[model samples]
Target: MAKQFENNMEECFSTSKGVFYLKSLSLEDNGSVSQVIKKRIEAINDENQESEEGDAFFVADIGVIKRQHKKWKTVLPRIEPFYAVKSNPEPLVLKTLANLGTGFDCASKDEIQRILDLSVDPSRIVFAQTTKQISFLRHAQKHKVKLMTFDNEDELYKIKHKYPGAELLLRIQTDKIKGSVNFGMKFGASLDSTKPLLQLAKALGLNIIGVSYHAGCLIAEPRAYRDALEHARSVFDEAKELGYDMNLVDVGGGFPATMEAGITFEVIASRLSQAVDDMFPKDVRVIAEPGRFYSTNAFTLCTQIISRRVVSTEGDSDPTFMYYINDGIFGSFRTLDFGYIHPVLKVLRKNQEIQDDWSGEKVYTSSIWGPTCSPDDFVAKETKLPKLESGDWIIWEKMGSYTSPASSEFNGIPKPKVYFTET
Candidate 1:
């Protein structure tokens, strides 16, 4: 691929101070993922930085990097952030957040070890896994990791036998969002069963510290937090009655980002803030573990247009085309689950100044597929994009969340090419 047009706005674009998105490819002017990636990589090369061994990058310095550091006024003071490691698990994302003083919510021994290797203190990590693998339990206890959660009696027994003195938190079940993914039924103990578990922990001499719960992912209503907050308040009152001093409240992550519509962070934050102020005790250390909210919209996915195939829409009014990219379900795009219909952009032929209408207005029912041989290797079922041939790169914006860590090495299809982009 060659540089298609000379940029007259390159100077202004390059001088942008903080993290920016959607400033490239003035043709559609819709900000495609691949164009931003190309420009970002070019910038990195221009600065004489050696491209790392991997063809993939999250571009933290430009996007999440700016949000993590140097933008306290905009990011911090809004919400207390605890990064969910299962989302990306990459060292760059973990290390960057840790350096910014962000705490982590680790689910497994590996995730916990990775954080600790970065010198993230045990106190800064919540061994949030609801399940108690004996090895993970011992590791956390040995590391003096102060907090872990459980919703059942069997896990309490494991803790009692392996690490009795380990501090613990009871995961309370609450219905945060009605239609949201049911985090409660999956991992949490219902309100009725919790009292008996508290007794079991006491009998085993396990230390009970605090309580926590997750309202599910992509929470769209601010009232969702309020619903959970009210439940937490009741649970706290019960714990206090049980003669246990609870000082921590883990509001598990479900805070929605600027998704297509429905709910916004500011709205969710307002509700969460009010819930804490109203119900959460002042001394109760309030913290949230948000995975997608922080990193999702902050980054994009750039893939090469490897092949173009025609779609047969025999008598149908709408036409369809299939643009095969190098990324697949392994690319982490499937985690969106909530219909990720974001825009796509095309970077045209290199070495040419603006070709008059080289880009057409015609929209095609584009289904972007991955290069895997499996039938299930598709990324998007029916996406719309400008028709294109091989060599043109297509970009998917707001793909910073579960995309990378969720990538599978099935069939040995390499991960999609990655790059960072900002204004």
Candidate 2:
């Protein structure tokens, strides 16, 4: 067991960028995530005995990430996952994914540099941003990172002038779907523009390798992939007519990471794999840029309540409560503003005892706020929970996506510390 743990830890740290250091505990004998949270809270209490400081922190389960990757392989064996670094770029997460032999989808020079710093080969990265700065293009050229994407004529001209040798994928717009974040409003060229773009690339003596499209984030319909794949096939045929042998089709990301999402990863994978098998040949490479699929459920965030207030409405007999936590919208809960994720809060502890549930107990309607002064920095506008006092810990699961990387130290409140465990 010790040898296995050491080997796993070594694999996780092998590609470290040295941006941060982490100490991970290996849980054995059926240890639970709640147990890990309890242990860390106790350690924090012991260390801050005099200050009585109970700050926010994260407990990341690295083992969960490994399981997610394994599941991805089992379900979609043909397609490769190029993790969207913008999701959670935690060093441990990156290192683990890198060691798992997954590719990376980078949007900026910094993201590319970070992956390169991990000693990752430039071949494993795709500069997926449709609109990119010239400086970013130059950086990619300097690093010998050749694969990239472009959707507009200006981008083609920029690439022709800057990185002429870079391989390109033409990003096409997908049909607008409801109940998902529409990415076509911002990126992707229309179908009418696809042939023109291919013609333009050919005229400019540029290499157009394939097609790419994003169905949208949190896609509700699995058939969305089928529609997008059909559109991509048309682009591939157009490229073929333009004397370009496109051998790649990037089915861009919108995969659900949690069970609460509109669709399951398994359903999406099943539909997507069938589409790919139908549309493209075996020689064509297929890849995806998944942001939330791997990180969402792997992290659990814990925040400490610093203060509370009782409010009595004019007509209501019961009083509503307001609780302020150490972290907020400007910090870890930044995704709330964008409606990307809604975390379900669990009480880790209240009055020094573990709180599994509030069953049979009187619950109060409460509002949760962050430490920032911004009135909009609310975690939950209305929630029902047993009365909680200051110093109590609240756990938010499935918080690994779009949280830390987008967070800021607004109002000078420190970011949460992260602890790692493998169960």
Candidate 3:
């Protein structure tokens, strides 16, 4: 696997400083991911004895991403994946996807430039933003990144004036499903309005080559894809009536990233593929923008406990504890503010035997706080945890999506550093 990765990805890893390398480890040789995390913590502790630099860090498994790509190909061979760049713009992650020959869904000029920096062809990138900035439009035109999405007539005019030759995807709104992020509220043209938009584009002599829709983020309803594809087929029919030969379908990202998601990727892929096969001909190119699907499971975060405070409540037999970690909502845990649930916490005691299950140990009602001055800088509330001390570690798995990229250096706390490895 390492040799194959080296052969396919080494050229993309070259930079001005040096070539980036991924530490390859087999489970039989190096044990499990927990052991790797424990070893990393030990090395950091040994090196930072005087500095006391117990800052949070991440261990990203590139092999997981490679496996995800392989799985995508095996399950949804008809549809191509254009990874959502905004999910986690870690350079190595981008390079790895690019090496695997996956296209990109870029929302900004910088994202386009990042993909281009890896020597990716402009055609492999789709400017998936609905309302693009004029400057960003100019940049995309300059770089020959032609494919873009638009939902409104004003955007059609903007694209016509700025990039008349650009191929376009008319983004239609999906059903207003409950319990999911409503991307339709902010973007996507209504099915009623898609025809008018297509007509306007045809009148402007602008190219309309596809239809796009997002069924919202972390959506569990597989029928959302079915309904959205039906809506898209209607738009495609409208375009055909307007003499536009639409050939692409951009099934916008919202695929679940974790097993905890109410719906599995396999089920969603099966439904989507069946819908595509039923609704459209095989000649049409099918693609999806999957941000969390490719990223969420590939990275794990480990934060060191910076301080611990025991709080006693009257009439309570056990004292409630509040432990503070180096990283917080202002840093890598910012996704909590956006309605993401708290990550399951795993305790790693200093100089203690490593065990996956801690059910036998004594547990206490605890609350975890971030190392921030804000009152709302809480990581976990009223959670059960073992007795832990300062300098001990807390592990969070499946933290790759919308964590690092959205992190801020609020209250002077820096983002966690990422270390790359492969299994």
Candidate 4:
């Protein structure tokens, strides 16, 4: 599986550094995943030494992305993945997924254009956003992107008049399923509105193709998908009664990138697979808009601590330490607005042996802040970590989704640079 990904890495370049390297670094050369990560980080640090301005960067493992695709193929073989372009649409990430024969779930005109620029077939793209600008709709139509999602009557009219040939999918509400960021509140239609929406589509002579629902983002419970699938089955029946061919069932993304305790991907996949098998027949095409699952685990964020503040506390408790990193909420930690917390941090010491025993090490209750001016530009609110100082480096895993795409240049903090490797 690793070899399959290695052969496709034609060009490996880091845009920020303006440097080029061969794509021949395979897993075998490094011995293990940890070794590969350490070697890559060392190389990145070597490059960073020449620049005066400290910049956070991402290490993207194409091998991890390929392994994820392979895992999906093994677990839920029937459901094809439409990689959500909104989540960490890094060029190399998209190119890798495209090369692996995965489809894309685009939301905006720019996203559609990005996928098209990759030379991906229009048939492999789904305009997955529920609300869209009129110009973006025309762009999709001009580009021949037929599959799109809608819920309300206004969207139906827009699609009917502008992109009449579009294959519409009714996005039903699935908020009952709790997640880190639930789309049911912002997107999906209520259960009561599903039938009328389908009727309205039929009245407008719109091509209603199927049903879709997003259980939530970073979902932990398998029962959530089971519940959403049941509603999808009901909507499929409604579409059929309205003389619409409801063949595609888009069980939208909520798959876990990193499972919480007592939860596993296999558990969710098994429950979802059983639900689909019991509800839909073999002819029905099942697809998912998985963004984080394929992304989060594939990238590691390397950030440098630029400054720190120590606040003395009362009496016996330890003082609170605040460490400021080069990147912040405005940069790769953009998803902090959605209540996503940074993972447990790993301290990478320069020219020092990796510490195995931290039992006697001085630990502090610390808060990591981004380099933004805003008081709320925090990455981790409260976590215990070994005392860190400026110039020291910290690493976070599972950072590829809902991070870079949502990043901004607010306060002049640029988005992190990304480097790709097949190993």
Tell me the TM-score of each prediction against the true structure.
Answer: 0.80, 0.92, 0.92, 0.89
User: Among all windows of ten consecutive residues in candidate 3, which has the lowest summed lDDT?
Assistant: 1-10
Task: Give one digit per residue, the lDDT tens place, for model 4 in 18-41.
Answer: 323335444444334346546655
Number of backbone collisions per candidate = 5, 0, 0, 0
For residue 360, what is the lDDT in candidate 1? 57
Q: After TM-score superposition, what is the CA distance of residue 224 in candidate 2 from its true location, in Å?
A: 1.0
Which residue pairs clash in candidate 3? none
> Model 2 over residues 1-423: C-alpha lDDT tens digits?
123244224233433245333333444312566777787677666855535346788878888888999999999999999999998888778877988999999999989988987788999999999999999999999999999999999999999999999999999998665445788888999999988888888999999899888888766777778998999999999888889999999888778775534677898899999999998889999999988889988888999888999999999988999999999999999988687766767885543556657988899999999999999998989989898887788889899988988999999887876667766
Candidate 3 lDDT tens digits, 80-193: 999999998887888889989999999999999889888899999999999999999999999999999999999999998999999999998875754347777788898788
- Please state the error at residue 201 of candidate 4 in Å: 1.3
Local distance difference test, candidate 4: 0.80
Q: Considering only N, C-alpha and C atoms within 3 Å, which residue pairs clash in candidate 1?
A: 2-350, 3-351, 33-395, 34-395, 332-403
Q: Give the candidates in order of lDDT, highest first.
A: 2, 3, 4, 1
Candidate 1 per-residue lDDT over residues 120-207, each given as its tens digit: 7898998898897898998998898868898888898888788887778899887546645667668888888878887777777778
Q: How many pairs of residues collide in model 4?
A: 0
Question: Model 2 — which ten-residue stretch has the worst lDDT?
Answer: 1-10
Off by over 4 Å in 1: 1-36, 39-62, 65-79, 259-261, 312-319, 334-360, 417-423
Q: Tell me, by lDDT, which candidate is best.
A: 2
